[model samples]
Structures are given as C-alpha cells and as structure tokens.
Target: MPLKLYLLPILTLFIMTFSSCSKKDSGSAVKPTEEGLKVSLTNVTEASYTAAAGSTYTFQAAVTSKLPSSGVNITVKAVTDPGGVNIPQNAVAPSTSGAIAITLIGLEPLRTVLVTVVITSTSNPDNTITKTFWITNKAE
Candidate 1:
C-alpha cells in the first residue's frame, strides 16, 4: 500500500475526531426569565416562637419579587397537630409594602409544634421558599 493512502485515512479520522470535540457556545441559548421570591419574618426575631395556649399569635412577614405576582400563597402545616392550627386566610394579594399577616392559635397547652410555612409566588410557582420553625404553647 502507498504511504499516502494510509495517511489519508488517518488524517480523515483525526480531523473528524477534533471537529466533533470542538467547544459549543451553549451559553447563548435562551433561558426562562424567572425570579425567586423573598420572604422575611418581620415580627419574629428568632427562629422559634412561643405563645400562650388558646391565644392567637399574630406575626407579620414581608414577601417581595422582582417580577409581578398575581398573589402569594401561604401554606402552613403543624407537625405535632395537623388539626390544631387554624389559618384564617391562606391566599392574599401582594402588598405594596410587602407585608403580610400570619396568625396561629395553639389549641393545646404544653405542646410543641413544628410549623412549616411555604410561601409561593403566584407569578412563578416554581420559585418558592420554605420557612420551618418550632412553636411551643405555654401556660397563660
């Protein structure tokens, strides 16, 4: 066989391998324009909270988003007693000042509940954040 014939096949294979391995500009692809929601508890300074048993504990939170939101959805769950916590409102419109009220009443005394609060931005439901805290009912 001629040397040029062998070189031609090898050169073709080398060129094909290098061309397929070339870097691609994947960064230029279009991405979804979604922003995350920000939630902050304004009244609760600590991660955990305590309140008198049989009394309603009211707290304020601030939620903001860069994009316009239809409203905010607040879901609360009591790890200790699912039926013990009472929520007056779960869905609320976005506040201009980004302030919302979260009220909870502990029905049992000397009981601790692990409260999970999930705040979801209606504009982008996927962009949600969760806040988990413990709440204890104390004797009045």
Candidate 2:
C-alpha cells in the first residue's frame, strides 16, 4: 500500500478518537424558590348605576402589588362569554407604590362583566401575572 493510504486511515482514527472522547455535561435540576411575588386587587368597586337597554355602564378596578413596586404595569379588560365587550386600548402603570386604577366602558345590561387586571413587570417581561373578578348587571 502507498504511504498516502496509511496516512488517510491514521488521520481518520485520530479524528474519531478525539470526537468520541468529547462529552457534554447535563446540568442539574433547578430547585423551586420559596419566596414569590404576590399581587392583589384592593378596593375594587363599580359605580352604583343601573344599565338600561342600549345603554352603557362603566366598571372600575384597582390593583395593588405586595412585592416590588417598580416596573409594574396594569391593564384592565372586560370580557363576556360571547366576547362582544370592548377592552381598554392602553395599559396603565402604577403612579405610586404599585397602585393603579382602570375603568371599563360599554357594558350591557343583564350580562356578566369579567374584569381582568394583568400585572406585568416592565423590567422583567416574563414575570407577568393576572387576576380576574366579575360584576353582574341586573334589570332596574
């Protein structure tokens, strides 16, 4: 055999040996944290009013944060089962100490209005949270 043939086999063996020896270490499992951020809806109320046919009602929501006060934004939405309610166009950030208030409009009579407050950290976008409550309209 020519010397070139032996050289090719030796090179191939050397490459294979190094490649087989290379290994990746799998990382260990991450433990869950004991401390967690908490958000609460405080002093939430709707204006005392009656809704008539073809009329609109406004509901208000107030939210407070029990964790860090910075970088928290609140968005309020009103949802019906049929999905015909209109939500707010923009999200509002807490002006003081993670406190925000949102108002929803165009509510119908004899319908359940679901108010959802979504609290998100602008600093850490992935750390988003939400809370929901419902208000019912009765015929006057």
Candidate 3:
C-alpha cells in the first residue's frame, strides 16, 4: 500500500479524538432564568434649575421593579459627570407595590446631570441592575 493511504486513516483518527475531548471539557452550560427580576425608571419629574451663576435645584426619580411579592431592595443615586452636584446620602429600598423617590439637590446652572438608579435583589445580592437619566439646564 502507498504511504498516502496510511496517512489518511491516521489523520482521521487524530481529528475525531480531539473533537470528542473538547466537547466533554466544555462542561454543562446554565440557562438564564426566563422569569428573573427586572427594574425600570418609572418617572423623572419636577425637575428645575435656577438660571443664576450659583443656584440650587431639586430633581426627583421614581424607580419600580418586577420582583416577587416580597419585593426587592434597591439603591438609587444621582450622579453627574461635570461634578459639583449634591446627591442625598440615604439609599432607598423600594417595595414591589410602590415606587421609591430619590431627590438630588444643589445642581448648578447650564450643566448636564446624569441620574442613575441601581436596583439589587435582597434575595440575590450579587445580582444588580441600573438605569440612568440625563437632565440639562435651560440656557438663561
């Protein structure tokens, strides 16, 4: 028999062995939960800022969740990229039945403010979700 005939059979066996080992080493994959938790920014209203060079403003955010009846705990924060904004220190933990309100104070004029609401499940502390909203001051 020619060397080419022996070469083909040896190559075929080598390929099959490598493929089978790869599949087994990959291990079992976990499917994501279809009915897992989710969070949404319900409302952002009563937002106003002063036109003066130095002034104060108040902003509010409403957060809601679709967790179980027991509800999920969340931490809502107001963040700004430009800086010099005051977000409340207290963190809110909203219930499933009702939404939570977060207040931000002392925002500067002609600046953009980014508000972020982060929701974390008390049941699963490792799981966390976040949503953001942008507010721009009207030109004076």
Candidate 4:
C-alpha cells in the first residue's frame, strides 16, 4: 500500500508536467479574416490576346463573396482601363445579383492594359475592392 501511494504521486506529477507543456500559446496576434469580394471575367468571345483596332470584345463580369456575408450587399459600379484602351465609363451592371456585361473597343495600341473593376459593399460603403485584368492592344 505504501509503494502504490508513492507511485500515485509520481504519476500525478508526470501527468501535470506533460499537460502544462502541451498548452497552446496565446501570445500570437489574431490574424485578420481574409474574407472579401472576388471578381472574374468571362464570356470573352471571338478575340485573341492581341487587341485589334476597331474590334469589339465582350466580357461578362462576375462578383461574389469569398465570405457569404459580402455577397448580400455588393455593388459593382465601374470598369475602367487607364492604359489607353477603350472601355465603357461608369458602366452599369445588368444584374446586381448576377454578372455584368462589359464591352471594350480596341482603340489605341498598348503593350499591356490593366482593366480595373471596382466594387463596393453597400453595407460597408467604405470597404472597396479593385480587381485588375491584363490585356494587350496591338498596333497594325
């Protein structure tokens, strides 16, 4: 009985030490959530990577939430290309819940054009996300 009693105390001490060492660290900074809006271009038909002058290319713009909460109150307001490529200014989205159809005219030649799409959350108007796509306009 005396031997068993001594072993019990030793076993209890070992278990306590092991558990204390296994405790998770709480000193790390809380990482911010990466949830946000996402944008994609689709339905770009009958066009090559090189933009041809006077050629019209169409694309369907889609917006969704990486987090479900964002999908509810999102607004895609405009699409612009500052690289001298032609795009409709203040282009309206056909459907707030669906994709927006975007059109561009291959006007000036740009080695690379950055097509920027801007979207905002109505719930959080200050929160905005910009997505850019690259295209090229070829000079004849």
Best by lDDT, which number? 1
lDDT of 2 by residue, 1-140 (tens): 69987999999999999999987778876643322345655444433222334334433333343444355666777777456566444555554454455555555667766667677664555667777776555654
Best by TM-score: 1
lDDT-better candidate, 2 vs 4: 2
Query: Whose lDDT is higher: candidate 3's or candidate 4's?
Result: 3
Clashes of 1: 0
Candidate 3 lDDT by residue in tens digits, 11-119 = 9999998978774446766644323555544334323322323333333333344555555676655555577465554655455644555555545566766666566
Give the Å shift of residue 79 in candidate 1. Answer: 2.2
| Candidate 1 error regions (>4 Å) | 1-32, 64-67, 81-97
Writing each residue's lDDT as its tens digit, candidate 1 over 1-140 gives 69977998999999999999999987885646566777877655446765545545567767655633466677766656444554333443454446778776543566666666787766667878888766666765
Candidate 3 residue-wise lDDT at 47: 34
TM-score against native, each model: 0.58, 0.53, 0.48, 0.44
Candidate 4, residues 1-140: lDDT per residue as tens digits?
89997998999999999988986888997645545667666753222233434344456667655533443343322222443535444445423464667665543454455555566654455556665565555654
Q: In model 3, how large is the Cα lDDT of residue 1?
A: 69
Give candidate 4's total backbone clashes.
0
Candidate lDDT scores, in order, read 0.65, 0.56, 0.55, 0.53
Give the least accurate 10-residue stretch of model 4, judged by summed lDDT: 71-80
Candidate 2: regions farther than 4 A off = 1-36, 43-69, 82-90, 94-96
Decide which is better by TM-score, 1 or 3. 1
- Candidate 4 root-mean-square deviation in Å: 9.7
Model 4: residues with Cα > 4 Å off, grouped in runs = 1-35, 43-54, 66-90, 93-95, 109-111
